[model samples]
Target: MDDPRSRILPLLRQGERLLWVGQPDPRVRFTGADALLVPFSILWGGFAAFWEFMVVTTAKEPFFMLWGIPFVLVGL
Candidate 1:
């Protein structure tokens, strides 16, 4: 694979220096807030998905189903 930084070098202006070049660590780091947020997020997402599913299956109007689509995608 080509160096990812190669593409960035030409974009630098004259006399400018590239001091740092690196990729972010591909690891999951959790904070104390995650203890509350994680479960809340799961419940919120589950409810959104369930709402969309019910709307799609039970609703006769297209508007109702369409309204919940964005919420479902955002939940994902």
Candidate 2:
């Protein structure tokens, strides 16, 4: 009996490019399957959290004072 899967393998191999379409392969994932989404989500979330923290802290401060003056004077 001839296997169709075996015939398809040669064509797949000859393509010479990798795409996430094969089954039982090492790179395949069905959930959170996209490679770029996880890292992008993490970076975006971290920046957003830092921005919110700075805004809230500044709002609660009673007076706006020079926090970065000494370093500026020393550098010049």
Maximum-lDDT candidate: 1
Q: Tell me how far the alpha carbon of residue 33 in candidate 1 is from the true structure, in angstroms, after superposition.
A: 1.5
Question: What is candidate 1's TM-score against the reference?
Answer: 0.58
RMSD of each: 4.7, 14.4
Model 2 residue runs over 4 Å out of place are: 1-33, 59-76
Give candidate 2's error at residue 25 in angstroms: 15
What's the lDDT of the predicted structure labeled candidate 2? 0.53
Off by over 4 Å in 1: 1-28
Model 1 Cα lDDT, one tens digit per residue, 5-75? 88789999999978888876768588789999899888878998998888877886799888887877776
- Model 2 scores worst on lDDT over the 10 consecutive residues at 62-71
